[model samples]
Target: MSKPPATILASVKQTASVIFLHGLGDVGASWLEAFNTYRIPKAVPHVKFIFPNAPIQRVTLNMGMPMPTWFDIHGLDQNAKEDQPGIEKSSKYLSDLIEEEIKGGISPERIMVGGFSMGGAVAIHAALTSPHTLGGVLALSTWLPLSTTFPKALISGDKKVNLPILQCHGDQDSMVQVQWARLTEQGIKAMGFKQYTFKEYRNMEHSSCNEEMEDVSKFIVQNLPKVD
Candidate 1:
């Protein structure tokens, strides 16, 4: 029997515009509460949301415990990388999910891709390198992975597209170093990314904050392509 395709949880309305990928271990359902509590109320009339779960893998931080992850952690003492087959598969899976969303009446320009932690890295990588330029990208406490094509994408310029990205990280985040976030922001800006937003919340840990989420809402409303 063929394996079942990964499921993505969506909001009540077909207003699906933004697609969210969750961090390691946490399921897509974990995002629903945040969406309902924060993003839904400020919902732009036609903007819908999608949360896709990463496949299961062995996480280094969790004592090599096998859980849902976009890529393998490899070793506890090492950093995150996208060199493994699982990582590539997960990336392609995310790409396919975006394609599916497009076929369901959501234009690439109308779709925003985002996530927390590891999910954030995946979203950022996929959005930056994808053939189609997404509407916007929200990466919360996420960093740029090592195996990205940012250099080529940089030299290519924003010819085919220019996307606005919203990235947030915590100064007190122990999981992903705060400096990495800064590096990601600096690198993207240097690469001719004129429309990117970065936020570093003081004293916050490795999770989302009300203010950051609020900024996300504003950014989403602001950057969405104006429909005629």
Candidate 2:
């Protein structure tokens, strides 16, 4: 029997309001450093950060090595499109976790979801597809997933969700390519979707930079559910 692909590591802090999804081949625990430094103590100080691990699965590209992945990489070989099953399944798992958080007293308006790499892509999908609007969605070095629409198209009749999204990508990213990010932003805007902010870093690779994290921290602080 195969193990489930996703697991949520709730923070010791009961007041956590932020959740993080780690990328392919990485575990959720790996992001603790950034969350503690950039996201936790500074931005959403009282917010608890939930780090959810993607499921371990046989990746088509990595010689079928079972690694943490939200979706298959086969489509990545075909111009970075996403596989529907993997994307949808992963989004459901993440959404379920978010709902549990809500039950624990964190309102949708007070919760923020973000991720890195494939995890970032999953974050984007979950945020848009979720029934409730969120405080914000932070996508780092990621792209839109399969079966997704932008601002207005994503909203149904009276289903308006004015979600502020933050997109950051590395200009020197060889894996995902900077152009993908640019094209995604353009496509969303062209479709009449707004309320998104994008930042592109020069000479950066597939990983997050301190400056980028710093900028993200500030954005969270400024946009998060304000305290009384």
Q: Candidate 1 deviates by what RMSD?
A: 3.3
Q: lDDT of all predictions, in order shown?
A: 0.74, 0.74
For residues 26-139, write the lDDT of model 1, one tens digit per residue. Answer: 878788578777855345656666677666767775788888888877542235444456555666677787898889877787788888988888887778767777788898
Model 1 — which ten-residue stretch has the worst lDDT?
Answer: 1-10
lDDT of 2 at 35: 61
RMSD of each: 3.3, 3.4
Q: What are the runs in model 1 whose C-alpha is more than 4 Å off?
A: 1-16, 39-42, 75-84, 153-157, 225-228
51-82 in candidate 2: lDDT tens per residue? 77776788887888888787788745336555
Whole-model alpha-carbon lDDT for candidate 2: 0.74
What does the lDDT read for residue 225 in candidate 2?
40
